[model samples]
Structures are given as C-alpha cells and as structure tokens.
Target: MRHGVQLLLVFLVLVLAVPASVSASSEGGHGGGDSKKKEKSEKKEKGDKKEAGKAENGVITIGPLVVNILSNKGYRFLRLEMIVECADNEAAERLVKADAKEELILMLSNKVADNLLANSGKMILRKELIDLFSKYTGPDKVKNLYFAEFVFQ
Candidate 1:
C-alpha cells in the first residue's frame, strides 16, 4: 500500500513537470523556428517603443554637444549628451526656444577639467547647469539636468 502511494506521487510529479519543461523550452529555444524568433523580436520592439515614450515624457535630449575643455592640454574636447527635464512639455519647448543648448555649450567650454572630473565637481556642475537652464527657460521652468554621456579627453 505504501509503494502504491509512492507510485501515485511520482505519477503526479511527471504530469506537472512535462508541461513546465515544454513551455520553458519553447520560450527559450528560439532556434526552434523562424516564427519563435519573430515573436520574440516583436515583443522586444513593443517594449522599446513603450520605454521610449515613457522616458521622454517631459524631457528634451540634446547631444553630441562638443565643447573645448579649458585643460592644460591646449583645450581638450568634451562630448556630451544632455537630457533636460522640465515641468511639462511646454517647459521643454521653452527650453529649446530660449537657446538653452547655446548657453550650456558656452558655460562648459569655459571650464577646466579639474572643475568637472571629480564627483563633487560633477555635483556642483550639475547644480550650475540646472541654474543656467532655469535662467534660459525662465524661473521655475526647468526641473533637472542629466548627463547621458560625458566624455572628455
């Protein structure tokens, strides 16, 4: 009687494990067919579109901004991708019209690497940039400033 119960338990385990293993194999083994690969790619594309929409809700992206750094190396270049956040889309529009990029480029171009390379220096620079952006977009218009890419050499 105990052996019969053990056999029943093993039978139930097999019943549950088969479907799980089959589904796992189907989801992970895209090499099985073109259709699986196509389905996975489609899901990825949908996710990317949703993320892009969310990420730029009240943000303006500006970049490949190249400025001459006031370094001892006879002015090295700093390439940046700046992302600015605002109260809303209207503020973002105002930021663009107020020549925000021009002001930022001018401000950074006048700075030495020592004023920007350290963590504390970067924090100070972020605050300064936010203030400069606010000045350009008008009081209370700009919310935050981010460096998507900061490369100096």
Candidate 2:
C-alpha cells in the first residue's frame, strides 16, 4: 500500500511539470518573435523620417524659379517655392522682372523639362542623371532625388 501511494504521487507530479515546462518554452519563443518584428518596424519608421527631412531640405533655385523635385516610382512633381539662386545676378533680375512663377508652373505642368526619372531602368537612369548634371553644374551641385509623399491607387 505504501509503495503504490508513492508511485501515484510521482506520476502526478511528472504530468503536471511536463505541461508547465512546455507552456513556458512556447510562450518565450512567441515573445522573442514579437520583439524582433517590433524592432524591425521601429527601424523602418526612423529611416522614413530621415528621408522626409532630407527631402524638405532639398529645395534649390535656378534663376527666379524655386524647385523641389519629388521623384516617385512612376512620375515626378516639381514644387515651386521662391526664387533664390541664379547663374548671374543680372539673370536673376531678368527672371524676377519676367514673372518666373508663371513660367515655372507652365513648364512643369506642360512637362517641357526632362523627367530625369525612369521606371524600368532606375539605376541606369540615375547614373545618367548624375553624369548629365555633373557636366553642367558639377557633381557637387547634383544629388539624389526622393519622393517625400507618394500615393498610388
């Protein structure tokens, strides 16, 4: 009788302990996976904010036209701000006299200027733009373009 009682107690303890151990291990594994996903999402958010700041600072002026070109996957938009920089002060004076705002908007709306953006050939197109801009304005004047806000339907 004594031996049978001891054996039953041992069996009960083993069954309970095994399930507790399994549940603890499973919960820990799930927690680790969740943390990793959260970390990845946080990093992505930080990168996006940095890109936006860079885009905001990318404003440039040529003659009397202030230009902020946003390059997206398929298209680009030139946001005109205020006239600031020019090749020559006299050219700046002429542009200011000629109503540069209207001209800039018209040129952008009509797509008269080259897009300098490509869909199927992104890398090659980027390299081409860099090369072209460098020839005219030197490499230091040209940098990469980014789309701060993008919407696709």
The count of residue-pair clashes in candidate 1 stands at 0
Worst window of 10 by summed lDDT in candidate 1: 48-57
lDDT of 1: 0.77
**Position 27, candidate 1: lDDT:** 62
| TM-scores, one per candidate | 0.60, 0.24
Alpha carbon lDDT at 26, candidate 2: 75
User: Which candidate comes out best when scored by lDDT?
Assistant: 1
- Cα lDDT tens digits, model 2, 1-153, are 999999999999999899766765675754565677689999999876533111233343333233444444444544433322323333333333334435544444444123433453434433543444344443454454333322221
Write down the lDDT that model 2 would get: 0.45
Clashing pairs in 1: none
Off by over 4 Å in 1: 1-55
- Model 1, residue 27: distance off in Å is 26
Instruction: Report the lDDT tens digits of candidate 1 across residue range 47-150.
Output: 76533222356787767578998987788988888788988776666555536667878888898987788988888988998888787667887788888998
Clashes of each: 0, 0
